[model samples]
Target chain A: MIRRSVAVAAAKLTGGLSRRLGFGGGTALPGLVAERIDPEIVSDMAAQLGRGSVLVTGTNGKTTTARLLRGILRSSGLSPVANSAGSNMMRGIAAALAESATWTGDIRQRDRRIGVFEVDEATLPQAVSALRPRAIVFTNLFRDQLDRYGEVEYVGGIWRETIDGLDAKVTVILNADDPSLAALGRRAGLRTLFFGLEDESLAIEKLEHAADARWCSICGRELSYSAIYYGHLGHWRCEGCDTSRPGVEVGITSIETFPEALSLTVSLPNDQTAQFKLPLSGLYNAYNALAAAAAASALGATNHDIERGLRHASATFGRQERLTIEGRDVEVILAKNPAGLNEVLRTITNNGRSENIVFFLNDDIADGRDISWIWDVDFELLSGSLKNVTVSGIRAWDMALRLKYAGFDTFDRVELDTERALRKALTETPEGEPLIVVPTYTAMLDVREMLARWAGKKAFWQED
Target chain B: MAKKLRVAHLYPKLMNIYGDRGNILCLKRRCEERGLDFELDELSVGEKLKSDHYDLIFIGGAQDVDQRRVAGDLREVKGDALREAVENGVVVLAVCGGYQLMGRYYRTAEGAELPGVGLLDMWTIHPGEADKRFIGNIVVEWNGGTLVGFENHGGRTYLGDGARPLGKVVYGFGNNGEDAGEGAARAGVFGTYLHGSLLPKNPKFADHVIQAALSRRYEGIELDEIDDRVEEAAHAAAVQLAMGRSII
Candidate 1:
């Protein structure tokens, strides 16, 4: 008991000190310190959660999905303890758990509490063993950091192995459109619930050039797709085998995407159809909503709860944050990989019009040192109308060069500093034009801070 | 009259992990800007290559599994044609995985042996400490021009005595983290880990390849100049960033 108390106290001290020193939320460090003091601190706290845990993981959309699920849990009368800041690795999850637990290592909420964590794809196996989650949501996988996570096949293989070992009681919620996750769900041989886009017109004509998962996961044959919503995700079948998109229990049928809002006509389980208007933008966020709704429903969340949560869920930081600087519209969008970036570009260029773009690319540990992925993004989509683009962050010039080769004519100052670049981009933005700020993970944080300071808003970490 | 440039894109699907398609786009766009009609023939797995059909050929890099999958197919179908193209002075630019496969062989991080085209007398091995992956912005000086790109590789390539290096590394880790070299060049073949997809950031280098191929294909055909103000600025900014003169 004394050892556990001491560990909690140490975590609190370091976390408090970290915040007081203005070094940011020190959320991960405290947990790192506590884990060093008590090896099983996370597992200990996790064991006491009567409702168990829900683990959400993938190459993208983990944070937003977790946030959306948290709202559903709240509406379902369960207090969800979640890692909202996206420090998804073990240390980050531990920090969140330790902060929410009592000094004696007991969760304050006890039976009313449910743990929700967005584990990193590479670290999913470790987290699964530690949390022993009651339900796991398998979001679609895309090619992410090659240096850090190898490739899509490697990460998918690990997820498969981990899911194979999970007990039958552990419910698996997955995206039916994703071939990789669909194959895993099939292999699980359990009553897995699936969520996917049911709107046929929403399908893209052709897959992006950098699309991964072209080969069927079950057989070595190439996959034939009726529609590629984005990347290798959407309505695909293996010609060499009977592998294909599974039957979806929770599906999105009619999607009306707007600049600030999205309305999805969802077909729920038990012959229930509900209309939901989400405050989030982009088809990617719609997919996240479907995943969250399906997971929440699998965990016994009612349709009313799912609808309310979907309606109330707002954009998580850096996903599609909107700020007005002096009456000029500025949107902060995060793009970590080629697929995500292409989606962002497509979303921003929905009307086939170019918005003033500020690109923040960094090689910090979080941003993945290889800026080569920029070449994979379809910048040509915006080349015809893109007139003003300001490149910033560590690899600002790299992005500028990519835009240039994509045949974009205008190249603003390539500012190494994100703050200065943000100002230039906003100032240069034409009157009544929205400036889309696209940043990688670390650069997004920096740009968010600068924008928050400029607009007199609280930084994301400081938000309650 | 401007002559048409026929380019072969080797392994568009299997070996395009690092945005090698961008390299193809760069070549095509440059050719278009210079008033030359650019035709691209995309060859995938099991596709055969004919030497005389293309004036320029581009092969990209891939992940370990993809590299292994494509290497054998490359040897079976396109190996002899690739050798013939290089010998005929056709401009061939290979990056990262493409560069490694142009060598005699590549030993993967898992210690698997994958044979290369052996067009250049070089070999690559994943370092003893795999954690020492040479990644980040890199600057290399070659033929009086400074080239900048991002390199993420655990394989440390060493050139044999017969092979000449593309350039001396000005900043960041080069061919092997120890050697000051960055890429290998032999005859008309150029292999580098420079994948800001190489051509877009370095228009001059892109032009160098175009001119080399054009010079060999058509005599006394002058390439027209296109406006490159934006391209030049992008290149300068990349150089400044890579040289550490501009702190990000």
Candidate 2:
């Protein structure tokens, strides 16, 4: 009783001060609230809503899909409290809730009809238990952290178990391009809708190192791939079972890669193809957009609204988020895993320039603490023709070794001195070619801070 | 265009994780500098691996499943041909899982034991008795010289009495064993879990492996004088780590 009163007082104080300060929920507020009240207080707080919420979860494209859905919901006459700050954890969701709430812990009734949430896979079971979402959108499952997440199959098993007990009213959205995720729709019946790519141009002729989709999940037959987009996400089928990348209701009709942006033509369920241009590179974003459209369609959003909202949506922080660093247009790509890195490498090389490339590999605790994934990335793709490769970060030498083995020739071996490498890599950039810096999570933070120090206020400008 | 080296890359597509191809590129470029041949043959499963014609026999690391799939294929090649090639002399260097498989047997975490090539007189046990997280820099002294690389693996391997130890453990868990089982060198087969890419930065080790192969093939094979720049760079990198300074 005393703890409840204290938490209420704290919430009120924080809510009152948020108007003066820019932020509302501090890092420790969620723990404070959980200790004071029942852990289910937030769910109880959300129960007052007339329409249940939509939950989106995935390993790679969660933020992109969530942002797209958020915009679509807003355009369709609904306001959503999404964790737009890129915080996808429990505390982040709590912060989003606190932002949406009043001093008395009530969601503002007049704000909107629905709330779309992008959730981390590890936190999904807890979040689903707390906030019984009316619908759940699972993008795809890939090998993320073997140290944290045993494997993709383990995560897939957990998701199957989670969805089995849900009520008949629950709607499920899955990516058919993913073998593990597409398998979820098989047993789901009418509640599930699988969305994926149909374009042949995204297909990989041969399997790369991180090929996890070798066999069919259902029949255990050898899987055949007509086209591989990235990792195992592609057009695949089991010869024994009729399993394949299910025909998506919404799909990317065409994708034209520009020197700077990706032009996509998406065919919607309403018999109209909406041409959407994202200021980012890669088909992964196209998948993200398709997922958002599918999630929005479940919530009664129209095709026109989805298109407008997608145009309004932009790339999330550090996931191909671009910035101007000391007059050079730099793209901060988070290559945490092999799939993500392969996409980054493919996108950058599409421009066909042998230019200055800076790759930072920091195997910090938060960054999976396993640098073994670097071997899986096709460094061979970057080795032969690329000009002026600069390696930096804690595992800089390690990366250098990998690059050398991949058949790349470097002028010098730059150590983990990020500041020096950044300066040299940027300053010595060939007259016309661009300098692309691919960094891991922590390295991204460090590079951003370094850029902020270098360029002052301009470094911390609007990301979109 | 200049004739690219006729370098036969044994396992280009598979048997790699951690930039193992970097080692190939390093060797190819060094060969290219002197106008040597370069040709990469991607020997995948179901493909015959005739190591007779190749100047270099390069094999890389693979996951447990991949190792199992490739094991039978590797076993098909008469060990006598490889042994004769090494005896007659062919440069062979293996890394990580590849290094483990070259020995007698490899046991995975799931308690499944797989047969190794018996190339090296050793065996590897997966999910090493201790944590395999070998981050940062490490040093190993081999043949009165120091080689630098990073060590990261979960398998603890015990050396058989007949096998020769590659180097002493200067840092990290050398081979996840008590005495820091850094590497094993027997005949022409060189095995090490260390991936300093084992070449560009450490040229001496690269030359040594190549020399060991060349000396067997030719009665008086003369190694071209190697520039000391590669060893100088590796030494400088190691010294910085030893002094606790960033060399970047």
RMSD of each: 2.8, 5.3
Among these predictions, the greatest TM-score belongs to 1
lDDT of 2 at B12: 54
| Model 2 chain A: ten consecutive residues of lowest lDDT | A455-464
Interface RMSD values, listed in order for every candidate: 2.3, 4.9
- Candidate 1: CAPRI quality band: medium
Please give, for residues B66-141, the per-residue lDDT of candidate 1 as tens digits.
7887888878888998888777778888889889999999998778889999998899998544467787778899
Q: Global lDDT for candidate 2?
A: 0.69
* TM-scores of the candidates in the order shown: 0.93, 0.79
- Model 1, residue A186: C-alpha shift (Å): 3.7
* Model 1 error, position A240 (Å): 2.2
Task: Please give, for residues A270-353, the per-residue lDDT of candidate 2 as tens digits.
Answer: 677888777766777778878988888777778888878777764332333555666776656677788778877877777664
User: List-wise, what DockQ does each model earn?
Assistant: 0.56, 0.18
Model 2 CAPRI quality: incorrect
